[model samples]
Target: MSTLEPVEITAGSLHLRPWRPGDADAVFAVCQDPEIQRWTTIPSPYHRDDATGFVDGRSPANWATGTAAQFAVVDATSGELLASVGLQDLRDPAGHPGVAPGGDGEVGYWCAATARGRGVVTSAVEVLCRWGFGPLELARIRWIALTGNEASRRVAVKAGFAIDPAPRSLPHPRDGVIANFWTGVLLP
Candidate 1:
């Protein structure tokens, strides 16, 4: 496993950084939103343990292994967690951990209910993409959302993804039997 030197990003009014143990409470609370649970693959009945494990264990492990780079988007001033974003499902063309340039990955995010409608997500997404393209040197990043998830679709579009002319219906590996999602891609 490769170890990455994690970095923080500052967008217009948002700051993104690797998850920290101190963030468990906020993650636990934001993740309880029904919309978050409905749209993202986060467990339906999210528990405190889940949040603790995510912030304290999984997030860092993924980064250390070069498997995924996850961030907690927070208020620039208050340092409050506002959302979760990540370059996930990372892998090279041959399906190995994508720590080097030219690998492909998926961009995913979920916002806190209080943070919605403020353009926070779009701004964060754009900045994250810039960093992904720069330091990570990712060749391409894809965005996928389940059908009827207009909110996510809008964020994807605003972040510069050229969605397929006719959206495709395909199985989303994370959802196990996941199907019928819209797909879009951004190339660097």
Candidate 2:
């Protein structure tokens, strides 16, 4: 139902592209990182089937439905998967109202363990934010991380997000326990 088409974006040495079927193996491998499992909503065990479903089903479905614009951030020269970023629709897919205005989206990302500490994710985020602001015409892009995710917080700040001072309650990744979360925002 998307009025938009998925497109490729570039930022220096990185290219953000749509997920391909062949990317299942890389997706599975990246999701195996302990940091990813701990900090993200990805399934704890992160089975191969889960990656397959995401690459073959969820990614395409999101694009087709205009629910999210997700990308596999790759090294332009080597074509290596460095990370994943998404601009997720904040509006309820089931037709309920969203927490923000209609044009708001949420930014989420995870870095491959091998690709961490190198600024790959930060650069990719900057590019994604630009795309969201331009072609997607998003009014705002929000970022959230569980409290204590300093690495993610640093990335958001480095990419120009204004961090909120107050922490909010959010569902834990594994259990539904309420956990403190930090939020940030970037506006067009």
Please state the error at residue 30 of candidate 1 in Å.
Answer: 0.6
lDDT of 1 by residue, 27-59 (tens): 999998999999988887999999999999988
Q: List model 2 lDDT by residue over 131-180, tens digit each.
A: 88776666788999999999999999999999999999988757899999
TM-scores for the candidates:
0.94, 0.91
Give candidate 2 regions above 4 Å deviation. 1-3, 90-102
- For every candidate in turn, the CA RMSD to the true structure comes to 1.4, 2.7
User: Candidate 1: deviation at residue 74, Å?
Assistant: 0.6
Which candidate leads in lDDT? 1
Q: Model 2: which residue pairs collide?
A: none
